[model samples]
Every structure is written in structure tokens, then in C-alpha cells.
Target chain A: MIRHVAVFRFVPEFTTEHREHWMALVRALPDRIPQLRSMTVGADVLRGPASYELAIVADFDDLDGLEAYTRHPAHAEVLRISAPVKASLATVDFEIPDAS
Target chain B: MIRHVAVFRFVPEFTTEHREHWMALVRALPDRIPQLRSMTVGADVLRGPASYELAIVADFDDLDGLEAYTRHPAHAEVLRISAPVKASLATVDFEIPDAS
Candidate 1:
């Protein structure tokens, strides 16, 4: 399986409305995007300087499944909503080997 | 629970030996760190420009548990081994709320 991990640093002005919107969209994605095997997303509870505002981890069967999830219209919609208020973003996509 | 997610961009010269070493160390952590709830780690299978070589997600009971794991000597040892070969590192530690 391939897991895509993304961390988002939203603008300082990001509010609860943005949080609710983003979470709703992400939570609804598994149903919209068939290739999305599973997903877990949450916000930072700590006020540490190194903490990012949001983190998302999603699993797919393989690279192709990940590509499909990225290209899906539902995902594009989420990006459109997020782009304006997003300050920084970092992502890492890796394969889970059978053995540890 | 708090999830500590870290993505490592290894230096260009990072070798297979380094990969083996890191994997073995990470895989052994659960036995040594009592605060660790779970962990999943892997390397990038795709050579995309955006890819980070290694990704790790470790869950703990709470922020204190995470702090304990971070201060654990075994984890510090792993960090010492990885520092030289790591190029860039990005991490996001977030709380998983009770609701979706």
C-alpha cells in the first residue's frame, strides 16, 4: 500500500469555518474517490512553534490509486477551497513494505 | 491520541545500508518504548520530485506520551544515526479528536 502524508500550515487568520469546511470535504472523499482506501486527518492541538495546523494521511493500493485520488474532481474542489488560506504545505508519499 | 508524523528527505548519498539500519531501529522501538501505541514507517517507492525518502507515523496516548517517546534514549540514538544522512525533515504532530 502507498500512504500519502500531507501537512498544512494555514494562514494565521484561518478560522473555525475553514476548519469545518476542510474537514467535511476530506471526510467525504472516501465515498467520492473510489481509489481512496482510507484517510485520517486532524488539526494540531498543541501550540508549539513546530506544529502545523492540519495533517492528513491517506492510503491507496498503489501509486496509480494515489494518482487517481489526486486527480479526482472532489479533491480538486478541496484544493480550490484550501489554496487561498494555505500558508505552507508539505507532503510525503511512500510505499509500505510487506515486512517491517 | 496524538500522532507524530515525520517525513525525511534523505541526502542524495543516502545508501541502502542506511535504509536497512534505520528500518531495523524503527521496527524495534515498540519493544523498547512503552509509551508508543503504534508506528508505521516506509520509504518512497516513486522517484517523483516531490517525494520524501522516508515517512513515519507514530501514535501515542497523549502529548506526554509523545514527549516521553521523543526523550527516550533509543529514539535519541536513532536520531543520532539519521542526522548526518537526512537532508530535510518536516513533521506534524496532531491530536485525533473523538469525532470524525
Candidate 2:
């Protein structure tokens, strides 16, 4: 499997409602994107100095599956809403070796 | 549960061996820190424009458990080794609500 992890810090103007709407769209992705094996999205609870505002962790069978989800219209819709409000975004895509 | 996600960007000077050593230590953390419910670590595969070098995703039952894992000597040791070579790091700690 491949894991796609994204952490986001919203712009100063981003409001609570914006966050809620964005998270809702992200949480609904697994149902909308067929390539998603599993998905989880969450709002930061700690709000620490190093903390980002939100996170999305999703799993795919392979890079092709991940690419399919990334190009999916549902994901594009979510990004369209989030892109304007995002201040910083960092992502990591990595392989998850099967357990022996 | 609380999910703690950390993504790292290593310094330009950091070499492949340094990354391997760091990952080895991070992968061994669950055995040294009992507060962890589960943990996963991986080096980035995509090397995309927005990609960070590595990611660590760990779960704990609650904030207390998360704190315990964070402050544990073993975790501190890992940080001692990683901090010097790290160029940037971002973290998010968020609640994982139980399924209804």
C-alpha cells in the first residue's frame, strides 16, 4: 500500500466555518473516490506552536491508485475550496510494505 | 484516540545514511515507548515539489497517552538525533472519534 499524508495550515483569514466545510469535504472523499482504500481527516486538537491546522491520511493500493484519487473530480472539488484558504501545505507519499 | 502526525524535511547536508539511521531509530520507538497504540514511519517515495522527506504517524488513546509518548526518554533521544539535521518539521495532533 501507499500512504498519502498531507498537513495544512490555513490562512489567517480562514474561519471556523471554512475549516468545518473543508474537513467535511475531505472526510467524504473515500466514498466519492473509488481508489481510496481508507481515509482519515482531522482538525488539530493541540494547536501547539509546531502544529498545523488539519491533516489528511489516506491509503491506496499503489501509486496508480493514488494518482487516480488525486485526479478524481471529487478531490479537485475539495482542493478548489481549500486552495484559497491554505497558507502552507506539506505532503508525503510513501510505500507501506506488507507485513511479513 | 489521538493521532499524532509529523512530517520532516531534512537539511541539504543530510545524507542517505543519516536518513536510514533516523528512520531506524523512529521505527524502533514503539518498542521503547509503551504509550503508543500504533506507529508507522516511512521515507517519501514521490519526491514531488511539495513533498517532505519523511512522515511519522502515531496513535494514542488520549492526550495523556500522547504526552507520555512525547516526553518519554526514548522519544527525546530520537529528537536529539533528528533535531540537528532537520530543516523543517510540522506536526498535527488530532482526535479520532470512535465509530458510532
Candidate 3:
């Protein structure tokens, strides 16, 4: 499985409202798409320590599943909603060891 | 790779002193053990929103590597110090997608 960690930092001017909207969209993705093994996105409640305002963690069966999810129509809609407020984004992909 | 995410929560009275120790132990593991691939442990700077106090993220080649790290003398030492202040712990193992 591939783990994708995506963080979105936005202008604090719209922090609260933007966070709520982003999380809502993320929470809605798994229901709309398949191969989304697990999905979690939330605002960092801690004030200054967390540099990014929102984080989304999702697990896919493999890279193909992940790529498909990223290009899925539902995710595209989320991006559309996201474009207006995003200040910066950071992403990291890591591998998980296979038991076999 | 096997991703192990562990969250440790302690009595707030000792949070400051204890977190320093927990993170110190985690940060030290990579240098002490050969099996560790990656390790990160930090406190939740945002208050009230995050339930866990400290989260330790480590990725190992497989479960055997993970077990070796856990049973390794260095980790055992950390646990010995951790016992006095620990309140609760949560762990999850997930797979990362293989690009191949």
C-alpha cells in the first residue's frame, strides 16, 4: 500500500471557514470513490506548533489505486473548491513493508 | 514497508517533562538501531483539538524488523522510563502501495 500525506496551508484570513470546507470535502471522498482503503483529514487544533492548517491522510491498496483516486471526478471537484484559497501545498509518499 | 503509528497520552501534570523524554527516546532510536528506516515523534502543539499527546511514527522493512526494534535493548530502556508516566497508548499498522 502507498501512504500519501498531503498538507495544505492557506491564508489565515480564511482559516476556520476554509478548514471546515476542506475537511468536509475530504470526508466525502471515500464515499464517492472506491479503493480508498482509509481516509482522514482534519484541522490541526494546536495553534502555532502546526505549520500547516489542514492535513489529509489516505491509504490505497497500491500506487495505481492512489493515482486513480487523485484523478477521480470527486477529487477533481474537491480541487476545484480548493483552488481559490490555497497558499501552499506539501506532499510526501512513503512505502509500507509487505508481510510476505 | 510497515508503518507503525503510536500515540501516547500522559497525565497533563507531567506532560511537559514527559514529552521531552518521549521524543528524545524516539529521536534517538534511529541512531541506536540498524533496523529502523524512519522515526518521528512530536507533541501536539495545537491544544484541545488533538486527543493524543505524543505521536511516534516509524517505518520498518517488515514486522520482523519492527519486532526487533521493539525488543532491542535500547527500546526496552525507553519503555522502562516510560512506564512511570504513561496513561494510554494506541498503535496502527498500515501498508504502503508498492510502485512496481
- Tens digits of lDDT, candidate 2, A1-100: 8999999998878898888888888888889888998888888999888899899999999999999998999999998988898889999998877670
Best candidate according to DockQ: 2
Docking class of 1: medium
> Candidate 1: deviation at residue B38, Å?
1.3
The complex in candidate 2 yields a DockQ of 0.86
DockQ for candidate 3: 0.05
Model 1 chain B lDDT-worst window of ten = B43-52
TM-score, first chain, each model: 0.92, 0.93, 0.87
Q: Which of the CAPRI classes, incorrect, acceptable, medium or high, describes model 3?
A: incorrect
> For candidate 3 chain A, which ten residues in a row score worst on lDDT?
A43-52
Model 2 bad stretches (over 4 Å):
none
CA deviation > 4 Å runs, candidate 3: A1-100
Assess candidate 3 and give its TM-score to the true structure.
0.51
Every model's TM-score: 0.87, 0.95, 0.51
